[model samples]
Target: MSKISKLFKGVSGSSSSSKSKHRARGGPSPHEAIHKLRDTEDMLTKKQDYLEKRIEQEVAIAKKHGTRNKRAALQALKRKKRLEQQLTQIDGTLSTIEFQRESLENSHTNSEVVRNMGYASQAMKKVHESMDLNKIDDLMDDINEQKDVAREINDAISRPQGDDFDEDELLAELEELEQEQMDDSMKSMGGLPSVPSGRLPSASTSYRATTKRREDEDDMRMLASWAT
Candidate 1:
C-alpha cells in the first residue's frame, strides 16, 4: 500500500479508538487534548526541518562528486530520496494533528456556549418562581390609589377655602365711592361759579373758573393715587 494511505489508516484507527473511550475512560479534557496535539505538531515540524536539511546536504554531496565518483554520488542521491520521503510523512502527520487541535477548540467553545445558556435558563426559571402575578397587580393598584389621593389633596389645597366674592361687583362699588368723593370735593369748592347764561364772564370771573378747573384736576389726581 502507498505510504500516505497506510499513514492515514493508522491515524484513523488511533483517533477513532481514542474518541470512543475518551469520556468513558475519563481521558484528557479538550484543553489537554489540544495542547498535546500542538506539542506533537511542533515535534514533527522540527523533524521535517531536520530531514530537509539532511536532504540538502545529500544533494550537495551528489552534485559535488558527479561523474568523477559515481558510487559516492549514487549513495548520496539514495540518502536524499529517503530523507524526502520522511519529510513528506511528517508533513501529513502535522496536517492531521492541526486539524484535530482545531476540532477540539471548536468543540470546547460550543460546550461552553451551551453551558452558559443553560445557566441563563435556570436563572430565569428561579426569578419566575419567586414572582407572583397577583402580588404585582396589588402593588400597581396601591400605587394608583396613592396617586389619586395625592391629586385630591393637591386640589383641596389649591381651592379657595371660604367666602368667595364677586370681583366685578367689588370693582363697580369702588368706582361709585370714587364718584361720591369727587362730588363731595366739588361741594367743598362751593361748586363752579355759575357762568352767566347770556355772555362771556368778566376777567375776574374767568380767573375763578380757571382756578376751579386746576383744583378739580388736582383732586382727580389725588383720587387716582389713592385708588392705586
Candidate 2:
C-alpha cells in the first residue's frame, strides 16, 4: 500500500510538473484553452445540479421523520446541512469557473482580432512593396501625356483635310460680284424711258393736246407736198 501510494504521488507530481512546463512553453492556444475552460465549466455545472438534487432529497428525508424518529430526523437534517454546504461550494466554484471561461473567451477574441489586424497590415505592406510616390508620379505624367496625345489626334481627325479657304478673301469676292451685278443692271436700264421729273397733266387733257399737235403736223406735211 505504501509503495502504491508513493508511486501515485510521484505520478501526480510528474504530471503537475509537466503541465507547468507546458504552460511555460505556451501550452495551449487561446482557442484550445478557452474550449477546455468551457468544458470544465460544464462539468462543474453538472456537479452543482447533482448536489442540489441531493440536498433536496436530504430535506425530504428529514421531513419524513418529523417527530417519531428524532434521531433519524436529526441525522437527515445533518446530512441535508452537509449537502447544502457542498451545494454552496459548488455554486462558488461554478462562479469562479464561469468567470475564468468568459475571461479566456474574451482574451481569445482579442488575440484573434490582433492577429487579423497584423495580417491585414502585412498584406498592405506587401501590396505597397512594388509602389512608390515617384513611380506614381511618373505613371500619372504618362497618363496625362497620353491624354494630350489623344486629344491632339482627335482634333486632327476632326479638322478639314485640304479645303481651307480664307474667310476675308471669300467675303471680298462676294462684294465684287454684287457690284458687278449692280453695274450690269444699270446698263440694262439705259434704253428704257426716263421717269418724269414733274407731275403730268390729267389723262383727258394730255390726250387732246397730243391729237391737236398731230393734226398741225399733218397740215404742214400736206403744204410741203403741194410745193414739191
Candidate 3:
C-alpha cells in the first residue's frame, strides 16, 4: 500500500510483538512498562524533529531551484511530502504510547489502592481480635467503682475525728473565762492604794477657812440685795 500505511502497520506489529514477549516472560512491571513507553516516545519525538527539519530543507531546496531547474524542484517537493507523511505517522505512534503509559499508571495506582485497602482490613481484623465490647464495658465499670471508692475514702479521711463539739457551748465557755479574767482584773485594781492630797500647815488652813467664810457672807448680802 502507501508508505504511511506500511509504516503504521509495521509499528503496530512491533508493539504487539513486544507486548507478547513481555507477557510470555510474566509481563513487565508497571515501572518497566512505563520506562519502555517513555523511551519509545522519546525516540519518536526525535524522529519527528528530524523529519520536520528534512521537510523544511526539502521545501527550501524546492523554492531555490523553482525556476532554474523545474525537475529538481519537483523532486524536492516530493521528498518533503514523504517526510511530512512520516512525521504524521510518528505523531500517531507517540499518541498511542502516551495513552498506553497513562493506562499503565492508572492500573498501577488502582493496584496500590486495592493492596492498601486489604492491609487496612486485615489490621482492623487483628485489632478486633484483641478487643471485646464486653471487656471494655467491664473495664469502664471497674474504673467508675474505683473512683467512687476513692471519693468515699477521701471523705472519710477529711471528716472531723472524735465526737462533734457544740459551737454554742464552746463560745459560752470562752465568754465565761473572759468574764472571770475581767473580774480578777477589777479586784486587783481595787486593791491598789488611792493617791492622797497634800496636807497644808494648820495655821494657813485656819486663815484660808476664815477668808472663805467672809466671802460667803459677802455673796449672801449681794443675793439679798438682788431679791429686794
Candidate 4:
C-alpha cells in the first residue's frame, strides 16, 4: 500500500510539472501574439471584402442619379422593409394561432387570441392592398382634370365659322399686321428729339463738389464778416 501511495504521489508530481510547462508555452511569445493578431486582421479583411461586395451589389442594383433618384430608391427600400416587417409580424401571429389552436381548443381566452391573430392577418392584407393601389391615382386624376379644363378653354374661345378661319393664312396676315403696327410704333417713337451727347456728372461727385463749394463760400463769408 505504501509503494502504491508513493507511485501515485510521483505520478501527480509529474502531471503537475507537465501542466506547468504547458502553461508557460501556452502564454504565447510576443512574436506569436503578433502573428495571431495578423491572422485576426486577415480574417477581418476577408469579412470586410465580403461586406463590400454585398454593398457593391446593392449599388449596382440601383441606378445612379442625384437627389431625385436617390430619394426614390430610399422610399422603395423603406417600403420593402416595412413590408418585410409586416410579413414577419404576420408569421408570428400565425405561429401564435397554431399554438392557441393546438392547446386551447374550446376556451374563450383562445377565442380572443384567435380574433387578435385574425386582426393582425387582416391588417397585413390591408397593407398589401395599400401597396397594390395606384400610387399615381391622384396625379392621373389631376391630369385628366387639367385636360378637361383645357378642352373647356378651347371650347370657350369662339372663333368664326370654318370658312372664314384659315389658320395658316390668318397667322401670316396677323404676323404682317403686327409687323406693320410695330413699324408704325417705331416711327412714332423716332420722331422725338435725340438726347444731347453730353453726360451729366455722377450724382455723388456732383453733390460732394457742391457741398464743398458751399462750405468754402461760407468760410469766405465768415472771413469777410470778421474782416468787416
CA lDDT of every candidate: 0.92, 0.88, 0.93, 0.69
Candidate order by lDDT, decreasing, is 3, 1, 2, 4
lDDT of 1 by residue, 55-92 (tens): 99999999999999999999999999999888888888
TM-score of 4: 0.20
Candidate 3 lDDT over 123-154, as tens digits, reads 99999999999999999999999999999999
Every model's TM-score: 0.53, 0.56, 0.55, 0.20
Q: Pick the candidate with the highest lDDT.
A: 3
**What is the Cα root-mean-square deviation between model 4 and the actual structure?**
40.1
lDDT of 3: 0.93
**Model 2 lDDT per residue over 1-228, tens place:** 699999999999998997998789889777777777778778878887887888788788888988999999899889888888888887888788788878888887888899999999999999999789899999999999999999999999999888889999999999999999987998888854777999989999999999999999999999999999
Can you give the lDDT of residue 150 in candidate 4? 94
Question: Which digits, one per residue and each the tens of the lDDT, describe model 4 over residues 1-228?
Answer: 699999999999997986797588885444444454455545555655554555554454444433558876675555545545655554565565455444544454566788999999999998887673476677788899999999988887865555667699999999999999987998888755677799978999999999999999999999999998
Error in Å for residue 70 of model 2: 1.3
What is the number of residue pairs that collide in model 2?
0
Q: Pick the candidate with the highest TM-score.
A: 2
What candidate 4 gets wrong by more than 4 Å, as runs, is: 1-26, 64-72, 75-228
Q: Give per-residue lDDT, candidate 2, residue 117.
A: 100
Q: Which ten residues in a row have the lowest lDDT in candidate 2?
A: 28-37
- Candidate 4: which pairs clash? none
